[model samples]
Target: MTMKFPFQIIDLTHPISPDSPSWDLDCGFTHSNFIDYEDCTSEIKFRVQQIHSPLGIGTHMDAPAHCIPGAASITDLDLHRNYLLTQSVLINVSHQTDENYQITKQDILDFEARYGRLKKNVFVLFYTGWEKHWPNPEKYRNNLVFPSISAHVAQLLLERNIAGIGIDTLSPDTADSGYPVHQLLLQAGKYIIENVANAHSLPPIGAWTLTLPWKIINATESPVQLIGLVR
Candidate 1:
């Protein structure tokens, strides 16, 4: 079928590999070739690979079950919610440092004041310029001061009926043991996309996003391929 609107697709996911940086607690991504073409004897050479990694590794989407008990899992997430074609808004919080940096409700209000009100079901993205440190576990994961979304800001987005939230960092919350933003968003049946790349390439508004997550039954989260369909 032909698309109604022509779009320039912008990838927003980082390549997953052994070198990909994951949460300190999650297992590192790895892959090995099980069947190589060099070992094939048949006329048609076959190759197979085995992969092992945690669900939260790489660019992924978190289901409500990730933090909320008795909530929906990766497979239970609505397809419409996982794959959405709606307006997206990018809030530039890149200037804010990790030390004492927090995205507050006031930040949302200020963004609206400058870029206009956020539309319902809009995919809200935060560009913290964190992707510049991609693939470097030391700089990207350990030493990085990731800006986190405050609980109040999360509630504000919920009130706006946002489809989901994405960030160019390992997570939407700080490295604290308790993640209030994740708890609030997930418990509300809203999804969160983490480790998003190229967020800075998107505009403050008017971009459309398409996020595709793996269908893993009863899984709390799944890696995703997020794309921005720019006009």
Candidate 2:
């Protein structure tokens, strides 16, 4: 099948690998060849590899079930309806934030003042300049002091009923905060994308996001292929 489009597709997902920063170090990514070429002695030769990765490795999507028991999991999501070409609004707070920075509702308001009011169901991405530490396990993790979204911002976004939120860090919540943002957003049934890459290249409001995740049954989270289509 041949398809075409007049848009620039930017890959927003970090390449997952054994060295890719994992939120949980114990669950780092690994892969091995199940059927190697050296094992094939017959005319038919093929090699099969198996990968082992935690749902939170690299760029990933968190289903509501991630924090809320009985909430929708990866398999229950309507990919086309919820993620297909969804409008993306980037809230660049990099200039004003540091590792311990917490994004607030005022930041969203500041963004709106510049990019115009965000519409419902648009995927909101935060460019925290954290991607600079990506692929560096120690730095990316940074003792979990990375920038995060405040509960107030989460509540405000919930009120707007945005499609979801994405960030260039390990999580939306600060480590010491006990996942307050995660609990609030997930319980509200909104999905979240974490460890997003190349977020700095996106416009404030003219890009659309296409999020595709591994459809793991009963899984609360899955690694995802996040892409941006510029308008």
Candidate 3:
């Protein structure tokens, strides 16, 4: 039936590494072409000879020409708003003595007073549970504060006109240099989904937030092999 809903596709990716932990505020990830084969001698055809990357590397999504100077990249937006069947909301505020965990405005008004006010286009997912430092570089990018989203909850999800917003870790902007919530959500044209892995495996509410990015045209950010179809 393919319309399940409950929760558990939390994979806010970020394991590309020169030594893992990236972001001095830009460019870092290098996984090279690893051609491997054992045996295939029949009606066989295969070729994926190691594709290296840097469309903003690893578990990505940030188009609107990545901060709106020219705007509308990431394959010129509108792949049905990049796979939206949303209504998934999780706000955990990841803790381990909270290493600079930003995300406030009373955590979006206490999660809309406990799950209510989030409509418009609905697809906000930020569980900040930073996946236990997946590959760790002093717990992801030399931590100071990388659990983000707090320019007043990115202007209160653009005053609830919400059509997009995703995060599990890596770049929601707790400031490393200057991302200002990716320049206030693509300059209010709104759209942002980044590094979302195993948002602690869902179930903070009903689930069905399938984000699918990669139509790579002008490519400012791409590679969103997402899934969260629980029931």
Better of 1 and 3 by TM-score: 1
Candidate 3 residue-wise lDDT at 165:
81
Worst 10 residues of 1 by lDDT: 77-86
Better candidate number, 2 or 3, judged by TM-score: 2
User: Per-residue alpha-carbon lDDT of model 1 for 124-228, expressed as tens digits?
Assistant: 999888788886766787644666788899989989988889988888887763788899888888899999999988989888998888988899989998999
Put the candidates in TM-score order, highest first: 2, 1, 3
Candidates in order, TM-scores: namely: 0.92, 0.95, 0.30
Q: Please provide, for model 2 over 20-55, each residue's C-alpha lDDT reduced to its tens digit, 9 standing for 90 to 100.
A: 876665546789999898798889888989998778
**After TM-score superposition, what is the CA distance of residue 80 in candidate 1 from its true location, in Å?**
1.9
Query: Which residue pairs collide in model 1, if any?
Result: none
In candidate 3, which residue ranges exceed 4 Å CA deviation? 1-17, 20-52, 56-59, 62-73, 78-90, 93-115, 131-135, 138-162, 170-192, 196-220, 223-231
The residue-by-residue lDDT of candidate 3 on 99-147, one tens digit each, is 5667777877887889878777677788776756756656665554666
Q: For each candidate, what is the lDDT?
A: 0.85, 0.88, 0.68
Sorted by lDDT (best first), the order is: 2, 1, 3
Judged by lDDT relative to the true structure, which candidate is superior, 2 or 3?
Answer: 2
Off by over 4 Å in 1: 1-5, 25-27, 81-83, 98-100
Runs off by more than 4 Å, candidate 2: 1-4
